[model samples]
Target: MTAILSVNRAQKKFSGLVAVNDVSFDVREGELLGLIGPNGSGKTTMLNLISGALRPSAGEIRLKDERISGHSAHHIARQGVARTFQLVRILPSMTAEENVMAGAVFARNRLWGADAHGLARKLLARVGLDGRADMPVASMTYIDQKRIELARALASDPRVLLLDEWLAGLNPTELQIGIALIDDLRREGRTIIMVEHVMDAIRTLCDRCVVMNTGTKIAEGDVAKVLSEPEVVRAYLGDDDDA
Candidate 1:
């Protein structure tokens, strides 16, 4: 697989407190990479940094040999990197299809605007929202909101997709649908980095896992191996000695 994005020795600090320390990793083309850590372990912070919402104190972030560090969020977004927030980004008054059309902005160059709406319909359909396209977000549940968010992200036609806590709050049925949509995205060859706590979802979707602790990387490898590591277990299970 080809390396599409790389973070080398990345560091981010605020008020002399380090949030992400010397993190290094590479996302290969068409690979689903999982980021896992205990609460307050810098998972979301790292995601924010890479997505250009925050600036790193130091380090190099490359998108296929092009330096992307310090670039604005919108600039990074235009470079084929799209992220869906933990909270839904849809507007309550807008129809689900309209929400997705918001994402299809600037995509007309790809299809002359003739097929873009068709593409949005297909994305909505894929996420099981075909019948709910005209429904207002205020009338939808959390699960539907998330599914629409995923469709919006895909409208970018991205090379790398970063999903923040995509499975955080949902019922069993909702979880199943969420997982299925993510699986479908992967099957379509989108390289995804998912920071999620649902171990079952991670195991079912990610090709490998990167575990972090106290703002630093502790272990990384195939899902089962990393999940079984002593340090990995300690990070998630807690170290009682210090407490």
Candidate 2:
């Protein structure tokens, strides 16, 4: 598969602190890549850079050979990139369908009125929201809210989907459903980069893994191989027994 997205030596600084440091990786077309790490590992920062939520202090990000690192978030979204936040972001005042319609309205190829509404309903069902399209998002459960967000992202018809902790709050049953939903997307040949803490999902969904620690890339390869590395173990478990 061709490398659809590339982060080449990307770096981000916040004054004296560095959030992402010289990180580099390639996400191939139709690949589901896992970005895993402990808290404060610069994983989210890297996503922000790719999604254009934050500009990199150095280096570049390219989407299918086009430089996109310095573009605005909206620009990136319009250029076939869409994402779900670590915290589910839905319009509380809007119905599920309306929330999803917003994505279609401002997407890569903008849809409007009936077209957007039609697409929103289809996406809502795709993410298992089914008949709840008219329900207010604020009234939905956490998992349902997440589904809305996922549906919204999909509504954009993104070439690359970025999921930030999409499975973080699920119970065992919900976790299985969440994993299944993502797996379905993978089967559809969607290229995705997911940042998640659940090892089960990582093991089941990712074609490969990238491990980050304290703002730097530490490992990049097979899920089992990367997780077994001493540094990765230490990064998660710490050097001391308490970790």
Candidate 3:
């Protein structure tokens, strides 16, 4: 598989602290890559950097060979990169359909009025929010809110998708649904980068994994192998007694 996204020794600094330190990785086209580590291990920071929420302090990030490290979030988004936040972002005052329409309007070429609304309905249905399209987002459950966020991101028709702890608050049934939705996206040839603590989901979904700690990559390769590494087990899973 060809590299669709590449981070060449990327770094992000806040004041004197380095949140991501010389991290490098390649996300291949049409593959699902998992990022896993304990809290504050720089997983979310990496995602944010790739999605253009934060510019790297040093080094370069490329989307299919086009430098995007220093671009603004909206510019990167417009270039076919989209992401979902760990905390779902939604317009509580608007109906689910309207929120999705907001995204659809800017999807490809600024769809307007009826065209945007029509696409919004289709996207809502795609994410299983069909009948609930007219319902206010404030009235939706946490999982449904997540679905709306996903639909909004999908409306953009992104080339690279970034998910930050998207499965954190899901219940069993919802978890299954979410897993299936991810599977469907993979089948559709979407390139996805997911930051998750759900080991089961990671094992089942990711073609490969990258493990980080203290803002640096610790281990990477096949999911099971990386998870089984002694250092990974110690740093991420803790001692046997603790587990």
**Candidate 1 regions with alpha-carbon error over 4 angstroms:** 106-114, 240-243
TM-score computed on alpha carbons, candidate 3: 0.95
TM-score versus the correct structure, for each prediction: 0.94, 0.98, 0.95
Kindly indicate the candidate among 1 and 2 with the higher TM-score. 2
lDDT of each: 0.87, 0.96, 0.90
What lDDT does model 2 reach? 0.96
Q: Write the per-residue lDDT of candidate 3 for residues 1-243, one digit (tens) a residue.
A: 899999999999999888899999999999999999999999999988988889999999999979998998988888888899999999999999988887777664567888888888998899888888899999899999999999988888888999998898999999999999998999899999999999989999999999999899999899999999999989976888883
Which candidate has the top score in lDDT?
2
Ranking by TM-score: 2, 3, 1
Candidate 3 achieves a global lDDT of 0.90
